[model samples]
Target: MSTFGQYFRVTTFGESHCKAVGCIVDGCPPGLELTEGDVQPQLTRRRPGQSNLTTPRNEKDQVVIQSGTEFGVTLGTPIGLFVANQDQRPHDYSETDFYPRPSHADWTYLQKYGVKASSGGGRSSARETIGRVAAGAIAEKYLRLVYGVEIVAFVSSVGCVEMPFIAQMRNDRALEPEFFQLLDSITRERVDADMVRCPDKDVADQMRDEILKNKEACDSVGGTVTCVIRRVPSGLGEPCFDKLEAKLAHAMLSIPATKGFEIGSGFAGTAMHGSVHNDPFVNSTVDPQGKPNLRTATNFSGGIQGGISNGEHVYFRVAFKPPATISQAQTTAQYNGQGGILAARGRHDPCVVPRAVPIVESMAALVVMDAVLAQNSRSKSASLLPAVSKSNPLMYGQPPSS
Candidate 1:
């Protein structure tokens, strides 16, 4: 289903090359402050032509809020958001619909629906994600305010290039924004100094040389993104039906061109014994002033236990395949019910890892916000008896006077 989440449902619509693409967010709580300005920055981050490393398709991706709010606060109604398609090259894709672009949804969409949008891979295009990013930005703001949750994602690999471990790169004394700025600067320098988004200076140079060579030949490549989430609370997921990691995986896989998803110690956990993979809990103090707390000595389970959050950091990785539209000529069929071959002609990213970083962060925010709302609902239900008892002053910390 296009819609996701039981408590915070979001449905995205529209297509590439269409007049506009957008999303409708249902179940957002009333009184939350929201505006078009809050969602615009994230959209701009994912818009095409932001950098030379991405597709040349230029779209301003200006967002417009249509409904579900009065003044600037949400009204417990469906939130509608739209981003117009400013620059489109429909003629370039006029013939692509009938023949199907290689490694794209053209064939699968046809097999499923018998018809497809004739321009720019239609619904399958990355353009559709504009709505997702916009909605995610709102979700992210809510999550941060309610739960103090923060998510950071970046290009960990492009071709053979990879960044350093996040822990090593962090500064112990710096604040959040400062730390992020440091990281962003380092990352940008590494990417700008070379074509690859890798943080390793030497490896980035090598990756750039290789990508430039391939670009010259009109081919493309793919890479992976690593996301780290901090300060996620405990007990934030339904056990079997709607596990947090499962929900996150579904969201990530739904993004266009995503091929794989893995949480902490994912497939590699198979290589370890149960004893090694387990996270052993220890009695601990919550803080300098708080009561005793539960803590895990290891995070082999990736901050999740029993399909629910364990109040630890959540870490994951997503893998994307090379852009399907390669300059190399390949054999295929034509719209006239005839067989032939065609070389893809268009401006496309040789590697998508750089652009995918923000997309991954956006999807993560949506999942976290949904989980937070579910947890709040459960907390209120479980505390009804306690709340009633507290209201009766006579019963406060006392046995029944029978």
Candidate 2:
């Protein structure tokens, strides 16, 4: 689908190498503060040429708010956002015209549309995500302002260079309270501290070296990104198909090159018994508002149960495949049904997980923001109901007593 979300609909447009790329965001609440500055941080993080590990293409990816805001506040109308493509190198993609890159959308896109963009895989390019990041920025700002939600993502693994704790946590099928605390304290500043974007300095260095090795070999690598959403209120997401995790998976898998999505224990939970996987809830002290809070002794469920948020941290990991285009020579079939050697040429990232951090965070924000809006609409309707009382005949669809 070109558009995403029910309450907070976003329809992105343009493509890689196009004159511009952006989106139209609808259903944004009014009277909230918004500006280009609020959206630029994520775009800058997702932009190319940030480091030697990423693509050398230098795109400032500056966003312009064309409509839907006045005096720095949203007008609750459709928001028009745009970012011009300033670094397009269409000639570099001429090689792909005759033969499709292996494991790329070139073959499938040609089959689906009977036509394809002449350069840079068009919508298949990572550059297409610029619109997503921009729209997500607005969603994120609103989420943070209204619910104090914090979303952070980091490169958890690049090829075999995984975080030290990842294997252990998978084996144990448990997450420590300390880990939650650490996740709570994590900021984009920390995630962006190094080029690899892994919070652990040692692991990040190892990941960097791995990517450099792949780049040197004219190859590419794939990895996973772990994201945590904290301070999300309970009761988001519908019951069946539109469940929170389901919607999250939909949003995540929609991103280019994303191969898998897992929440909480994810695939690891299957190895353990229900006794180990089930989260045991315990009563907790009240919040500042004097409302009692319930917390689990263990978060094996990953802050979600039955596909819904439980007033705990909602976290997930997205698996990304290696960039399909590599300079390495590969023997593949041509459009004429003949065999030939193809060596992709064009600037590409050796490993995409580092840049994918912000994209993951941005998609998560859109999902959560959409859910929040849906819940708000439902809550508003429910709030108008009169209290159940025998004296009130209107409760039974009759006239009230005079």
Candidate 3:
């Protein structure tokens, strides 16, 4: 499971307190321009100590491209990447020596591995995402160069303070027309204008206060990240399973602390009657080649239908739980299976949604890149075969006993 994607495969290594963390990205198209500079921005975004809102673990998170390219061009080989971990505080986790931190991986890690790291969450830590984010950046470069796909994610909420005009981000309520408009226009520049990363200034201020409030109390709060991938070519995803949305959910939930996920209309579509929920198709503005395109009048399907991309903006949300390593005293149990009070001590985000924005964008890029490569491979292979119309009997079912 350390490796992800059948086409653009990525295998990550190292641990939270390890000397370094990084990944080997295979299947990048040879001759595409790439280098450490191409990957470092995202790693910086995912790195700790960005602000008071995040952990004080000061990792420069500077990525070094160890191999897989010659003079900034990928060789289509396994690309080696790594970042040295500069900050270490094994003593901070001394509390974990006795009691397993509540709601953390400490106990389960021991249960699964028969042992666990002495400091930090080890492989389970968000630090592992360094590799993911790094690899994702490479995929993103290719996606943007060939497809002009733009992936953006922002903090949509923090605790009870949801971004204004996002409708509660609940599953039962469909988004307003204006929300879709916002989805089409929102940019990372706007989202990153503030440290909280909320697009709206007022909302970002509120979210900042919320995090600061919890930070001061040695408590934590959870929130949601909304991501939009625009200009995605249609016809990605598998039918039986591995649907685009399913793969998206798989990627999003893989991030540490992610608890929930929803796509496009998501849960809210359920409340509407079929008549109101369905997205009606229409003629598109057409591509530069003047080929007519099909599009939805309303995007309740979230730019995907039948588990495939529909040439609309693909958007979704991921909800994260409060950081489990809150320093507040909690009545929990010891690793010896006894009752006790565990006051966990560590540097963790009071709210993770801000820092999670790039992580979300990176994972989204990975999913899109995988789907693009899968569909491309299939399309190229199919192009060599004789064309068969839908009217052909074999197209309907297995041809008359083979």
Candidate 4:
């Protein structure tokens, strides 16, 4: 259950209060130059104590490379990474002994394992994502160097405040022009410049203040993160089962507190007629052989059509529920069906969207990376066969009869 991806496989380990938390990344191509420097910055961004909007848990989240590299180059073997749990405070969670803590993982984990971790949320904690972030950085490095892929995610909303796309989403599902431009030109540097990690400076400030307000009230709030992957090549997905958007949804929803997942025109496009919802093609690309390529007139498909990438910017949004471990008192049931008021004690984010930004981006990289490897395998194998001629009924290039 711990492992993910078919080709670019990764297995994560460790609990919230464990000695260390990390992952083993398998199947990375050899000779790719990698080091702690390539991975640490994202871990640092995912770390706690970043700002007033997050938990006060002062973890530096320092990462170390344990194996699978020789002189800072990946050897195409399993890469082991670990980050010390230096600032963990398990005692703070003692209140969970009496009650399961509503909306928290305490009750279900105990039911599932017949036992639970001694402290914190155990494997249920967001801390478990350190391994994901680490593995993703490696995948990102490969994608970046070889394919020029760029993934950028930002806090699109915090509680009621939303980025313009979400704010004005209508049944027609035609998002704003500015939203498209934002996807075309946004950068991580611009995203990180804001206090709340939202690229729009004005929205970031308001989101920050709102989170501080929730923090002061000992409550938690929910929000969403939007991610865009650019320069991903066409035909990178499995059909019928692992559609590109389906895999993206699975990966994004796997994060600790994710509540929902939607890709380009999601939900909002449902009300539109096919005439408005369909993406029309335009001849806008040229191959190295000087052949023209078909491009989408509108990206309503979100860079994917028929379960494959369409060589356009792939964009999606993930919604995170409020951090379940709030310090506020609440009436809830105990493990024995007894009822009582519980005031939980733990360090959790008032708003998770800012920190979830990197997690979203990393998971996107992993999905795209896995898809790349799968497609590459197929392409290589197909190259060995004779090309299909127009006379063949099974020709892949032939469109279906109307």
Instruction: Give the distance in Å from residue 71's predicted Cα in candidate 3 to where it truly belongs.
Output: 0.7
lDDT of 4 by residue, 230-306 (tens): 99999899998999999999999999999999888888878677998898988866677444568888888899998
TM-score of 3: 0.94
Which candidate's TM-score is highest? 4
Please give the RMSD to the true structure for each candidate, in Å: 6.1, 4.3, 3.3, 2.1
Q: After superposition, how far is residue 76 of candidate 4 from its true place, in Å?
A: 0.9
Scored against the true structure, residue 214 in model 1 reaches a CA lDDT of: 68
Rank the models by lDDT, top first.
Answer: 2, 4, 3, 1
CA error at residue 107 for candidate 4, angstroms:
0.6
Comparing 1 and 2 by lDDT, which wins? 2
Give the CA lDDT, 0 to 100, for residue 5 in model 2: 90
Candidate 1 versus truth, CA RMSD in Å, comes to 6.1
Residue-level lDDT of model 1, residues 312-358, one tens digit each, is: 77878899988898878888877676888877766677777777776
Q: Considering only N, C-alpha and C atoms within 3 Å, which residue pairs clash in candidate 2?
A: none
Cα displacement (Å) at residue 152, model 3? 0.4
**Which ten residues in a row are the worst by lDDT in model 1?**
166-175
In candidate 4, position 67 carries an lDDT of 87
